[model samples]
Target: MARPPRFDTDQLLDAAVRLAAEGGPAAVTMAAVAQAVGAPSGSVYHRFSGRTTLLAEVWLRTVERFQEGYFAALTDASPPSGGAGGPGPDPARAAARAAARHVVVWSRAHRDEATLLLYGAQDFGRAEWSEEHIRRADSGNARVFASIGGLAADLGAADERGRDRVVLALIDLPLSLVRRHLRAGEPLPPHAEDLAEECTAALLR
Candidate 1:
C-alpha cells in the first residue's frame, strides 16, 4: 500500500487562502504557503508549477465553489416555463431574491474565500497567466454570465440597459455589501440581507 502524504493539498490551499485574505494575493507565495502548513516548499511545487499556477488554482477553486451554490439559487429562483406544460407561478422575482440573498449568506460563510475573490485575479497577475489558465478563467466567467442572463431573460431584461441593471443588482449590489463588511472585518449588518432582497426585487421589477 502507498503511504499517504503528510501534508494535505486542501490544507495548503487553506493557508494560501487565508494569506490572501489577510494581506491580499501578493502575500500568497509558495514558500509562505509551505511555511504556513509546516511542509517543505517542494511539496507545493510538486502540485503547482509556479506562482501563476498556484494563483490560478486558488482563483478557480474559489470561483467554482461559489458558482455551485449561486447556480442553484438561480435555478430555484427561476420560474418554470408557462408550459413545463402547465401554468406555474412566475419565478423571476423569487429567483432574483434568492441570488441576491445568497451573496450575503455565502460571503459570511466563506469570509476568507470571499476576500480572495474580492481581491480578484488581477491582483494575482491573471493577465500574465498561461493560455490554458485564461481559458479556464474565461469558461468560469461565461457560466456565471449565462446563469445571470437566464434570470435576466426570464425577467424580460431584453435591452442592454435592462441587462446591465440585472447585473448591477444581482452582481454589483451584493458584492459591494460583501466588500464593505470584509474590509471592515465586521459581520454583515442585520439589515443587509433584507436590504439585498429588497434592492434586487426593486431592480428586477
Candidate 2:
C-alpha cells in the first residue's frame, strides 16, 4: 500500500503564504517552501507537482478563505425566508454594512494572502486544467458580485451596473490604499477604518 501523506498540507500552505507575503509570489519556490517547512524538497514535489501548481493552490486557498468570511457575514445578517435572504431594511441593511466593513478588516488582516489572490492568475499549460480553473474563477466571482450587488440594490443603489461599480470601488479602493501604505512604509492611517465605513455608506446610499 502507498504510504499516507506525512506532512500537513495546511501547515505547508501556511509557510508558503508567509513566504509569499514577505517576498511576493516569486519567493514561493519549491525549495523555499520546503526550507520554510523543514521538509525535504522531494516532499514539496510530493505535495504539489511544481511551483506553478503550488502557487495556484495558494491563491485558491486564500480566495476560499476570504469568500467564506464574506458569505458568512452576508448570510448572518440576511432576513429569513427572503430571496437568498436579499438585503432589506433594518437588520439586513445593517448586515450588508457589516459585510462591507468586514471586507476591509479581512483584507487588512490577511494582507499577504489578499494581495496574492488579487494578483495571481492561474497558468494552465495543461489545457483542461486551465479551462476548468478559468471557468470556476469566473463563475465564483460572478456569484460573489451578484450577491453584493443584490444587497446594494436592496439598500437603494441605482441599479445592477451602479451597484457593481460601487462594489468594485469599495473593494478595490481599500486594497489600493493598503498597497500605498505598504509602499510608503507608513502605518495604516488612524482614520482608515472610519474612512472605509464612510465610503461604503456613501456608495450604498
Report the Cα RMSD per candidate: 4.6, 5.4
Off by over 4 Å in 1: 78-89
Alpha carbon lDDT of residue 69, candidate 2? Answer: 79
Candidate lDDT scores, in order, read 0.83, 0.66
lDDT of 2 by residue, 1-205 (tens): 9887777788789888888777777788889999998889998888888876777677767777887777776656643232222344665465555666666677678766755554545432223345555576566677677777666665667866776756654576555656676655465676665565556555555
What lDDT does candidate 1 reach at residue 171? 90
Supply the global lDDT for candidate 2: 0.66
Candidate 2 regions with alpha-carbon error over 4 angstroms: 1-6, 78-92, 122-132, 158-161, 185-190
Return the top candidate by TM-score: 1
Worst 10 residues of 1 by lDDT: 79-88
lDDT of 1: 0.83
Per-prediction TM-score, please?
0.90, 0.76
Question: How many residue pairs clash (N, CA or C atoms closer than 3 angstroms) in each of the candidate models, in the order given?
Answer: 1, 0
